[model samples]
Target chain A: MDTLNAGSVSAMLPSAFPIVDKDWELADTYTLHFATDGAFDFDPGQMVMISQPGVGEVPISISSNPDVHDRMSLTIRGSGSVTRALGRLDYGDVVGIRGPYGTPWPLDTAIDQDLMIIAGGIGLAPLRSLIYRALARRSDFRNLTLLYGSRDPQSLLFERELHEWRGRFDMEVEITVDRSSPEWMGEVGLVTSLVDRARFSEADAVAMVCGPEIMMHFVGIALTDKGMHPDNIFFSMERNMKCGIGLCGHCQLGAEFLCKDGPVFSLSRIEPLMKVEEL
Target chain B: MAHIIDIDGLDGLIASLKAEFDVIGPIVRDGLIRYGPIGSVADLPRGWTDVQEGGSYRLEPGNTEALFGFVLGPDSGKTNLFPPRAPMWTYREGSFSATPDSTRPMAIIGLRACDLAAIAIQDEVLLNGPYVDSHYAARRSQLFIVAVNCTTFATNCFCTSMNTGPRLESGFDLGLTEVLDDHHFVVHVGSEAGASFLAGLDQRQATSDELAEADQLIDITANSITKRLDTTDIAQFLADNLESPRWSAIAERCLACTNCTAACPTCFCTSPVDTTDFDGSAARERVWDSCFSLDYSYMGGDPVRSSGSSRYRQWMTHKLGTWIEQFGTSGCVGCGRCITWCPVGIDITEEMAAMRAEVLAKEAR
Candidate 1:
């Protein structure tokens, strides 16, 4: 790991990135689009540290398309202090940005195979990048299906994009919600139920999932139950982290630092760990 | 490669190092022998040794005037290298600028073998990662280590068990073995800087017999360590025993004081905090955080490890078990600071033995 001589990749100080646009995805969730300075780039599943000047930093996955140069979008929910501050920012306001850290979604592994992107709640944010990349290279794979679930129809992220994706002839998009409103025309049930109902070549497909830890866990089980190989099931996990690199030990799950070794990990690597209580 | 230097020669070596670097060595501070700035040999804690036991550490006058007689205090090279509080960057208006490393190049004198090993572990974490910590890298690049092989052992000292020490194998500028009988040091120069520094000291090549004496001196402490940990499949064992009842027992006695982690050399978890002033200049500072702290593992609402049982398990298992898988080596150096400084005397070795005993007892039945 003599990466020091490779080049300086220190994120000690974050560069200022201006918020070019802000989209309120939901009541609390906002997709803040930033004008990248072209200093660095990131992959679909890789996350960046977004910080407010007075508030602290939080690790948020890249939400927008990787091919889209000049602008990077981060889908953030106003849950904590840093994120809440980020939610309050408007276009032209500047915030500190460090990163594009952690392992990216193994998108190349999905080539020539069916790609199933399963997302729950805010989990869709990380997979949105992958969806964009996959759609761009649609001919490379056999089938591309997205089975997305939210708490409610109102809480659904990327509503406009989901609408566009569903209208596309090449890709398949199925939406589900736990509870339904009068305007809701989608299926009502757990995302796991959506996984069972979805059609895909399970044995040949690679499923990328993200959400709450428990949600991801059950989704992994659902994918496996649907005859998908556990190894083909990749998850973008979230944990408490300070340093997005492996320095801070907060984001540890067994031997893996979710910040470094993952944000994306196959079910084969982390299944045993998920079974252990409070691990 | 080796030199036999008398007491004055040792003093002269210190003087030479002091001239070039900000030399830090053990000195009596606040009734404890802690690593502090050493201007001269007089500043060193000579003729003093620490009596370390489970939940107790007392420094007293020893019979011999050995400069490096004591084992480790609460602090290690980590205290200086990866400080408890380090300002990373400051933000004003929009842009962020890193806090400059204005501190001088440092040379540590009397660093034990465990301390060196622990620094190496930290190097793997902070330096060998995908993104190197510039502050640690700067301090590490400018630092010189003068490791002293253990000639005496404390009750709490168990470096031999972990195979880290009693003898300074490498990772030092100069390695010293204090020959107690003759009041001289058998110095082993490990680097070009050490060789250059030794050229200025009043020293002579150690004879075959003197080298044998130094080996014998190291062996005395090495063999005296009664503390042992059976690390055979220890990682898997802890991984399997996560739900073991020992956690319950530990939770009963464990205070969750974070004393063990604070004293530990390889425990490198930190929390970044932001401070904003009236003038609108905000700074992000890193503070040493322990897993025992309720908020250390906070994600959204409640912390990951809320109970005392879970926190203790997290610390011990990570240090002895999962650390190997994480860092390619065991986290614990067996310096025994965790044992000695622990208020309830919660020994890690004893806990591991208890867990093993429980499993073995089940198998036997």
Candidate 2:
């Protein structure tokens, strides 16, 4: 507490600049690709707080694989003041970055076991990192299946990667839309329905899900119905996070600070709280 | 080392401390005893004590003419350390700079044992946690604490059950116990600075009998506390009974006014707000927040805790239950300010006892 020594004082400051190298517009959301300064080190499910200074800061998940350390990407929709400001930035613009905070997905638990990933809408952003990490270490994992659903075909993220992943012999990718137009040829239903068609050994497969809270809850029920253990299912939660280091109480859920203890938690741990209304 | 000083010597002690520090002590303000800067011994709440109960607090004349006769007020040491609102940093254009207020060393006098315990809880949450809040750290490191051993207990007080109050054992630079019968004060030096401060005062080594008298007085105050809460595994019990119907029953009368959390010395929840000036310069400010507030759990539109029931549950569970899990200690110091300040007379000890009773009855059935 001795004047918070210079090093610890600067911990909250987002001094690192990650310049946008390329930007892609997918429907209402934009994905910014940045070449890291080699100073940013993170895990697949870790996230960084990005700020535009005069505007504000928001926690965005690292949407790219951690193995690709030289580059990073964050897919953000224009939801709030900070995101709207982020959406306005052009290529070569600099955004302040701090932290790769929160517990990463339990990828180690899925090693040498069949893995299933379910994503809804833009919830696919954080899961994209896990998917890429699993793909990069494909030999270490058994059968891999990704069940993704969007509001419609246009809302799907990583469209190009989804196509390439479907062609890969080692990965099974299923694409679905809530409502599809005539041009769409894939399944049209909720993402939970894709879990029914997904073929995996319930006893050995680990499921990782990320989406709206309502969707994740239903998907959790579907996974449980398939004879999946509650401990084997992980879900990433979203809350108002001010300080990613857990000092701010904005992300508190029960005894846990989602920013520190988890953004990703096992169903067995959070199921009871999640079942309680307005908790 | 322990020292004894005549009751009149308090003026000289205050004068000595005022030379180098902002001496803050209990003073009568608007018919209430509150901690504020005291310019002289005249500002102290002399010959006054407080009558505190659920939904009421009033200042009353003390039977003995002692300066530190009052038990405690709504505010504690945390009001200065954490503060209601503080600027974390200022931002303009694309750069940000943190300006932590490190000036003005503070000498807080008349802190009760329970308040000291509450400050320790804040230290664990704000200073020793995974992240250090720079604002809290800068202010806390400069504090000079002078704790007062309680000689009186209000009806709402339950510090005996919490094992944190009515006597000063640790977490203070200097400790004082009033011996009104002898018209003197027994002082214990807790640190090097405290020893030096006592050395400068016109004081003498305390007699063993005088020290024993002070211990007896504190023991009397501790035993006089009638209010109590059974804390044996209470945290785990509350955690297990999250869905209990007692919460709804309490919610029927509980008002989410947030007064309890505001007066709570250890409730360290805060919200960061970003404000921009006309010149396009913006600064992020950290303000005290309570879980009882609907917006404390707001993500965007509807808050997670929308009902009075959920908000009340969140506050009690976090304070008496989950706080131990998160910070390795119970958040409640049993100071009883929450009970006195609550608008609807929702006593936390009563609720806890009721919950335990319901659990026990269910088990029996």
Candidate 3:
């Protein structure tokens, strides 16, 4: 019976922010950076509902490092009308930004545990933020390793950051591609194949994975087969959501509202529903 | 304090209230009694009774001239509180702004016990969550309820099974029950506003005998409903039987036409639809969307629940099973609107029994 307060009702409206910079990973995918107006802080792995005023809205995970406040970024693929509209925007062209919402990676739990990260295609966007945080406290985490893959040598995202992390002595980085070019000297295979070479403490290891739905499922089995504890393995779940909160039912996966309870869930938590087809 | 008011006094009360607030009540339209704005006492559906069962609703002439001679109609009080289409906000002239609250101070008449429970469930879904829905909050802030206790039953009614009805316990401004045999309504003033409104209307203090009659009448309604649904471990039962063959059986008849969800008062799922004008004005409104819709479960490519069996499973399991995990309460009030409005007579209670029967048969082996 609690009624609305004396003030006006709060609407879920996004403020238009000017795109300060843009980075292209490929012809169809890019990332837009913005300067935040005020104090807006979010944990890694959280997403924002990016909108083109007249086009539409799409939920995109925040890719920029969480350590830096006052600056935000969303790496979007020009796959749909709304994203296409956002992709066309350049320096100073404004787009509405609505959140930094959803649960973040369990970085606190992974402390002192050997960390293994797996990402495919644009899936590295959210994990990229986590990687930055993990590297910031490198001594706190033991044996940090990242295994990443893409469709081809030409399509890997964050090429500059990948090169930087690859050269670091503290972290081990392995990259692969489904279809390789003649000039490509790195490993050429599905990301799961790279799991055979990556090493971690099997008894006290934590793995964070993100990719296509089917890819995540197979990678989960691969991680478990590699002796990683099922409970310690986490992956992200995606669904089309209109209202970034729990009200919109589009993002439902069985008992989970991916928008709120998680877009990130432990493998053990959703394994049953994932086994059931079309749940 | 409860007061006794005859039909004429009741009419006067409605008239006075109409002049002050926007009063809405049940009206007969398109051969169906639905909630609409009231102009006078004549606007209320009187001298009419409805025969409601699975997939059937027929209005028949009533033997009594009493105003509340009928069971509840299809529209639950949910539409008045959380409307089917609500505009969230608008964007124009280089800025975004919230949709202005244009709703008037309003009163809704003839709210039944089952519908009131549904409203409370929606209140939890929209209000008591991690995020509050301001659109529902605005309209709900200005609502006044005139709850009418059920004195009759439709064949599909099972509020007694859900433990939600036959007598309203709370969440109403004013409570009423027509003692048809005694030709008077005992009004229970539930709020200070209700007491003040009644002071201006014609009414007398109810004698002890009159209050006793009201209690007995409500008791009769509770005892008369024959339909029953056993909710013993229903949540776990449905969850355990996720792949139950009973779902496929129900799906064969379920047209996926969304009639059940549309008639259900507590199905609060919605999807946003945006519109833009040539003058650079654009807005977003959330429309009531059904789980039965093929696109509701879409996750990029083909919909997650493309088959009818999975869609029906999503609807029923979400209502009976998963909702408990989400909101700590089953999302059904047992008003039986889903049963009565379904085109194929798909009854949820009957389906649950069938699923249980299948499990029982397996155990016996």
Candidate 4:
């Protein structure tokens, strides 16, 4: 038996810091940008565990570009107790953070190939980092396309970024709303409807999707129908993750530990499990 | 020459062990044998054998005067290694601090061969995994194990088929084979610590005949195990049969009371719980969690495993199938704790046999 070095064992700890930048606020949702404290480093599509001292920790996607090493951003919706407490934070309020855990989107697979990004509601938060990463190396990829949908115009996140992305000649940006008011002038219906309007070679495109479970399921089907291989399509999955590492049993989907194995997994790998009812 | 000790020398050995470590051994608790701190050598469950079958366990006085007659109980080394509840961290002002309670060095006595295998399985899951469980690591590193070779078999025992038991091969500080008829114990030193511990005790070199007799007793116990699990490619077989109706069939009888997972020697799943005090302080704790629990797979609102069939399927498949992929070994040690402790008499070996038979039947057609 190997003797264990007691000094090596350490528990999960989070530090306190204030939100440096509060970018945008949508219905029950907001984006908080903070300094990385030089310790926090992450790739695009990875998430961090954030918490308020008395409150609990919740896994939130890193919405900022990876190139910006000094700071990171998290887009959150006040759904549960922890998120509700986070929503009440001001620009200088303190919060705790741990990790930049989980596997990132397979960007290398999309290199030199056309990329189609699909997101629904706040699901766009994680993909926002991927978009920035791709744009930073715009000449490396063939084309960039984004199809984003929200509950309505009021629920749309990163409005400025969407407008700027639409104006970019190197990218195709399409927006849709599930329901529209008189002032709303955009496509209306499920996000899957916009998949037909996007132009990309089915054989050469690498699709990345993030959304509600039902939305991702249908979008996956639509992508498959477009002649894209299941292996080429990737989606982010969400579960009640306690520890960002694999020790906690909360984020298990079949044999896979979603926290470490992936929050992002290929459709081919997870399709069978996805079909299983309630799993 | 094999080192052997007379049955009467157990008191001196326990006294020597108690001088440096907290000696823990089997004791009758609530009519069931369990490992607890021993104040003296008398704490050992002498002449007591537990009758174990599917969904049942009963303590009965044995015919022999053997000290280590009991095969196992509901508790294994896992209770002390990976405790049921451990504090991960505590938060007071605005920061979190690790509160890993320093554990006293312990000498766990009367560990069976199957329980030793279970400890190794836990070592892989808790210490060798991508993220090490600090509490388990701290407690496990300080353990001095005294393994007992099995001389008796329960009806639910299948360690012989699992290739984990009836005799201690390795993974112990010291291994002992109790020869009730001969009134002696054949002691095998596995670690230097065990060798040093033996140096302080009254021991004698055993004759070849005495050593051979101890070996034969272990062989008899191994052969006596009527329950068996055919583990030939069993992991892949279970994985392939994820959608098999056998799971639902077993689920009908499985109460999903989580007794199997709780009693399982190698089930290392845990769930984190956060509790807040009235003083505005909070602590995060990781408690022993079972996959059978409805909230085990909770994703905010509803649980992923909504049906008992799915929960049971997850538990069995993870234990017998995916655990091989994750840990390079089967999670089960064939101790039969799950079978004996289960309220509904759901036997894992029986389930596996049914699945295997179904596969063979399908191939025949």
Off by over 4 Å in 1: A1-9, A37-40
Q: After superposing candidate 3, which stretches have Cα over 4 Å from the reference?
A: A1-11
- Give residue A43's error in model 2 in angstroms: 0.8
Per-model TM-score, in order, reads: 0.96, 0.94, 0.96, 0.95
RMSD value for candidate 2: 2.4
Residues B91-167, candidate 3, lDDT per residue (tens digit)?
88767877765666678989899988998999888888887888777667677888999989899999998989989
Pairs in steric clash, model 3 = none
Error of 3 at B13 (Å): 2.8
Q: How high is the DockQ of candidate 3?
A: 0.47
Per-residue lDDT for A68-121 in model 1, tens only? 887899999999878888888898998988888999999888888999999999
Tell me the DockQ of each model, to 2 decimals.
0.46, 0.44, 0.47, 0.45
List the pairs of residues colliding in candidate 1.
Answer: none
Q: How many clashes in each structure?
A: 0, 0, 0, 0
TM-score of 2: 0.94
Q: After superposition, how far is residue B341 of candidate 1 from its true place, in Å?
A: 1.0
Chain B TM-score of every predicted model: 0.98, 0.97, 0.97, 0.97
- lDDT per residue for candidate 4 within A1-279, as digits (tens), equals 233334463646666667998855686888898987666778887998887766678999999888888888999988888888888888987777878889999999998899999999989999999999999988878989999989988899899899999999999999999999899978999899999767899999999999998899999999999899999999999887888888766687777888889999999998987987755
| Residue A99 local lDDT, model 4 | 83
- TM-score of model 4's chain A: 0.95
Residues B46-94 of candidate 4: C-alpha lDDT, one tens digit per residue: 8898998788899999988888888889999988887799777778876
Ten residues in a row with the worst lDDT in model 4 chain B?
A: B94-103
Give the higher-TM-score candidate: 3 or 4.
3
Ranking by TM-score: 1, 3, 4, 2
Worst 10 residues of 2 chain A by lDDT: A1-10
